[model samples]
Target: MATITVFGATGYAGGHITDEALRRGHEVIAVNRSGSAAAREGVTPVAGSIGDDALVRDLAARSDVLVVAVHGSADGQPYLAALVPNLLKAAAEGGARIGVVGGAGSLKVREGGPRLIDTAGFPEAARTESASHAKVLDALRAADTGADWFYVSPAAEFGAWVPGERTGTYRLGDNVLVTDEHGKSFISGADYAIAFVDEIDEPAHHRARFTVAY
Candidate 1:
């Protein structure tokens, strides 16, 4: 079984990934903000912040895979772009593969058209965070972390509002917004976790970014 370390184990996507990893019988080190955090069964919860370089390196040293599903502080700071590079450095030091939960803002709606974030109805409040996520992807793509780094962007319609059921089916895409038959782009948290853990089991699309949607 793989030793997976999840940095945002208490967050929405990270929580799902932690549970999914445990369900598959993998050892999970769930990192959160509080030491008293109760993650889930079979998960070893470690309270810490992503800003600590030593803490991140130590965790990555003992993990085969490191998943970064964290955002910034509660005050809405954009630290993802900053933390990712540090995570990449730690992963390289520990020789562990890194996977980051990216955003659909960097993904194109058409073959060569503008990104989804540039399209209509994109929330103004979310613009900064969305741009930060895209910047993280850009940093990852340019980093020389060898063969153990990847970024995964969810569909455009994925969020806390759309808590759909798990159908155990999804399709992967490359920097493109994935939509269904009716042009709806969405994926359930459970299903997205399924895809994330599946990638952990089978190392495909390395040193790159991919998307998952129904």
Candidate 2:
């Protein structure tokens, strides 16, 4: 099993991913701001600040994969601008791959159409965060690094509010959003974790971005 180090491991997406990785027999280093993330077998919870490039590089040096599940915006500021570069540098230096938990807003609503965040009627409050994440994806695509990386954008209805069951089934998509026959796009946290961990277990979409949905 791979040794996975997950930042923001106490948050919604990160928490599920950490548990799923452990369930799959992988060693997990769960990093959080508080350093008090709940204990679990096969997990070593540590407190860390994402802004610390040294800490990030140290962790990357020890991990087979570095998973970033934190938000793009922090305290009303775009955090990924600086953080992404640091991660790229660390991955390049430490011989570790990178996996980012991105938002659905980056995915196009339809092929050849505008992104969901750019679509009319999209929530204004979420625009900034979505834009930040979109920029991260852009940066990842443009970067030249030795380490492999992948970005995962969840479905439109994803999050804690609609935490669906771990059905162990989901669809994967490219730059476009994925939706069911009924025109609903969604995936539960557990199922999303399944996809995330699956990617770690078997690499796919290397140096690219993919989306998950029901």
lDDT of each: 0.85, 0.91
Weakest ten-residue segment in model 1 by summed lDDT: 71-80
Candidate 2 structure quality by residue, lDDT tens digits, 173-198? 99999999999999999999999999
Cα RMSD to native, each candidate?
1.6, 0.9
| Candidate 1 per-residue lDDT over residues 107-197, each given as its tens digit | 9997988998899988887787788888788878877765388788998877678878888999999988889999999998889999999
- Error in Å for residue 127 of model 2: 1.0
For model 2 the local lDDT of residue 103 reads 93
Model 1 pairs in collision: none
How many backbone overlaps does candidate 1 show?
A: 0
For model 1, what is the error of residue 191's alpha carbon versus the real structure, in angstroms, after optimal superposition? Answer: 0.4
- Show the lowest summed lDDT stretch of 10 residues, model 2: 76-85
Q: What lDDT is obtained when candidate 1 is compared to the true structure? A: 0.85
